[model samples]
Target chain A: TQLLEQSPQFLSIQEGENLTVYCNSSSVFSSLQWYRQEPGEGPVLLVTVVTGGEVKKLKRLTFQFGDARKDSSLHITAAQPGDTGLYLCGGGGSNYKLTFGKGTLLTVNP
Target chain B: EPEVTQTPSHQVTQMGQEVILRCVPISNHLYFYWYRQILGQKVEFLVSFYNNEISEKSEIFDDQFSVERPDGSNFTLKIRSTKLEDSAMYFCASSPIPGYTFGSGTRLTVV
Candidate 1:
């Protein structure tokens, strides 16, 4: 089974602070996606990294895929209270299934 | 932006009863998926549907679970004889390829 392991299951930070969450797996994936979910809501896609060592940034958020496609990272710069939510990483393999990580609960206090 | 729509945001049903969750994927998307997340647990993939048939399913998707794209836009997931353990937030997703767009989800509470 391909499993994605996320680090720092829980995080608490003040507004304007910076934080980074990591996702790692022993198996390689064709693509990796990051999602942010609020309470009582489904996950919303943030970004998808398809190529190895690729980095994509969206405003204050930055996502990076490992050179081997076995790991990924999400970095938030100048975090805000609105950014507080559950961050998830999903790995898409050769098949149609997507294996999701346990997720990191982020709390950005204003 | 197009979105995947799921019906019945919340459902409470007795154990051993049958329940069907519905979804309307994006008009142009070809792939559909079902996933569930128990409280405080990770999101788990249940099944994937493509071309009016199931392409992949996880171990958690057993005989009790079935999926159908009966019409042009509607996708449904039927859970026959639901157990208390089946209670969770079920999310429906659609994608053109690997990247998915998920619905708001239906919170299924099997009592």
Candidate 2:
């Protein structure tokens, strides 16, 4: 089974602080997707990285895919209270299914 | 932007009862999927549908679970006999290829 392990399951920080969450897997995937979910809502897609060693930035959030396609990371700069949510990483393989990480619950205090 | 829409945001049912969750995917998208997230757990893929048939299903999707695209736009998941373990947030998603757009989700609580 393909498994994605996420580190630091929980994180709390003051507003404006920066934090990074990591996702690691032993299996290689065709693509890696990052999603953020709020309470009582489904996950909203944040970004998808397909190329090895590729990095994509969305305003304050940055996402990177490992060169081996076995790992990924999400970095948030100057986090705001509105940025607090559960972040999930999903690995897509040739089978067209996504294997997801347990997720990192981030809290940004105002 | 087009969005995936799901009906009955919250559903409560007794164990062993039947429940059908409904979704309307984007008009132009060809891929539809169902995923669930237990309380404080990771999102798990349940099934994928394409061309009016199931493309893939996880082990978690058993005989009691079935999916259908009754109409060109409506995709539905039916649980013939729900167990307490079935309680979770069920999300429906549609994709053109590269990315997926997910619905707000339906919270199913099997009591």
Best by TM-score: 1
Scoring each candidate complex against the real one, what DockQ results?
A: 0.83, 0.73
Q: Write the per-residue lDDT of candidate 1 for residues B46-109, one digit (tens) a residue.
A: 9998888899998999999999988788999999999999999999999998789999999999
Candidate number of the best lDDT? 1
Please, what are the lDDT tens digits per residue for candidate 2 over residues B26-55?
Answer: 999988999999998899999998888999
Error of 1 at A18 (Å): 0.8
Q: Candidate 2: which docking quality band?
A: medium
Please give the fraction of native interface contacts (Cα pairs under 8 Å between A and B) kept by each candidate: 0.79, 0.64
Which parts of model 1 are misplaced by more than 4 Å? Answer: none
TM-scores of chain A across candidates: 0.98, 0.98
Per-residue lDDT over A1-110 for candidate 1, one digit per residue giving the tens place of the 0 to 100 score: 99999998999999999999999999999999999999999999999999999999999999999999999999999999999999999999755578999999999999
